[model samples]
Target: MREIDTTRVLCSLAELEVTGGRGFAVGEGDWPLRGFVVKTASGVAAYVNLCPHAGHPLNFRPHRFLTSDGNLILCHSHGALFARDSGLCIAGPCAGQSLTAVAIEVVAGYVLLGADVDVERLANDPL
Candidate 1:
């Protein structure tokens, strides 16, 4: 088996305010894995930007994945509400579905992609 390096720094933990979020991309060229990171009470969580309902990016505005109160993740396309910690759609067209999680880790105050992620594959495929 061959191992592809998908590890990349998404951002510094300090960049995300508590309950706030930020979008990021891995790889380059036409297809890069698009994702976002949210700072939670326990830690940071990351997920693919694609929304399951319409298969569209969750937020039209950069780093605006959270609701006004920052309690849940919001998909602007259809008003899908998701649990920020679990990415589970609590309501909307895609209810019961989830935003694909992008494994991540906090290292030295920077958010880094986990070793298991396949950038090329994830970039080309939507779940």
Candidate 2:
């Protein structure tokens, strides 16, 4: 695995699920920026863990963010399925809605938070 600058690193791209998903957290204190990263054909995509339909964390099990077949993002809370690359909810209570995407970049085989993002603010915002 490649060593990344920890201040911005989320995970090593190699550690991310190739046909599934992996959960991650950034910052500190009560409201760290919780999210997940999914491996996609074009590269990687990430989103806030909060589900749009219920404002709940999408996974009930750790790092279990993708559907069994590994084609979509699954919210274990209520079966909401989202497109892996776009984070758009295609079915379920929040149909036509979308997951809140966290800006991420792949660098030196590491997934990282975009430099311009405010971690504390994004972590605390209810939206």
Candidate 3:
């Protein structure tokens, strides 16, 4: 994955969940990172949090993206389910369509995306 400067600060590793419940910020997006996951061994994975099925956020609530079994990402809009590892819609109307992935990396104990960036401008914007 290329770098995405707008996707910054994926949260402290200490505050992240094991099954990967986390949120971050995208300087260019309407909202900061709302629905995201952090797999301990796979770095960080992010999405627009919008379900492809009905154009709604996948999480039941902000920062809450998970299934009862914690194996899939559930779309609160229609009970659609997506495989967390691939973000592929496995059931429901969104099946086949997937969440858009945001690029990210860790540096100096911080997570940062390194694409579609205007670093100087983003630094000047409010959080």
Candidate 4:
């Protein structure tokens, strides 16, 4: 089995099966790197929790980032719909904008933040 890195683990693959997505945070204090991971058709994708339309966290409820049908990422604040894989805003006020992608990979049945990502930088300058 591959050695697991507990520090970087966001959520288990099994956990995503229930909700289709999961929110996570990295770092500490004032502003940790808040993000979410979603299961995509191709594999999985991660993005900053901040929505481009109103700069609000996409979900109003915990881990509820998908539409009712589990098709796209829904911004609860303003009804923005984004592509699950690419984070592109396909509908709503911010049509041409996209969510800030976070680097992540699944290994040993767990999702982990990519090694090169700077948590502090991302949390501070989410755009």
Query: Among these predicted structures, which one has the highest TM-score?
Result: 4
- Of 2 and 4, which scores higher on TM-score? 4
Cα lDDT of model 1 by residue, 1-127, tens digit: 4333335789888889743898998888977889999987689899999999988999988889999999899999999999988999999999999999899987778888997888888888858
Of the pair 1 and 2, which is ahead by TM-score?
2
Supply the global lDDT for candidate 3: 0.61
| TM-score-based ranking | 4, 2, 1, 3
**lDDT tens readout by residue for model 4, 1-127:** 8888899999999999988999998999978999999999998999999999889999988899999999999999999999999999999999989999999988988999998999999999998
Candidate 2 on 12-105: residue-level lDDT in tens? 8778755467788898887899998898879998898999898999998888888888889998989999999999999999999999888988
Least accurate 10 contiguous residues by lDDT in model 4? 1-10
Q: For model 4, name the residue pairs that clash.
A: none
Which residue pairs of candidate 3 clash? 3-114, 3-115, 4-113, 4-114, 4-115, 5-113, 5-114, 5-115
lDDT of 4: 0.95
Please report, in order, the local distance difference test score of every candidate based on alpha carbons: 0.88, 0.86, 0.61, 0.95
Q: What is the lDDT of candidate 2?
A: 0.86
Deviation from truth (RMSD, Å), model 4? 0.7
1 or 3, which is superior by lDDT?
Answer: 1
Model 2 RMSD in Å is 2.2
Q: What is the TM-score of each candidate against the true structure?
A: 0.90, 0.92, 0.69, 0.98
User: Could you tell which candidate, 1 or 4, scores higher by lDDT?
Assistant: 4
> Candidate 2 vs candidate 4: which has greater lDDT?
4
Q: Comparing candidate 3 with candidate 4, which one achieves the higher TM-score?
A: 4
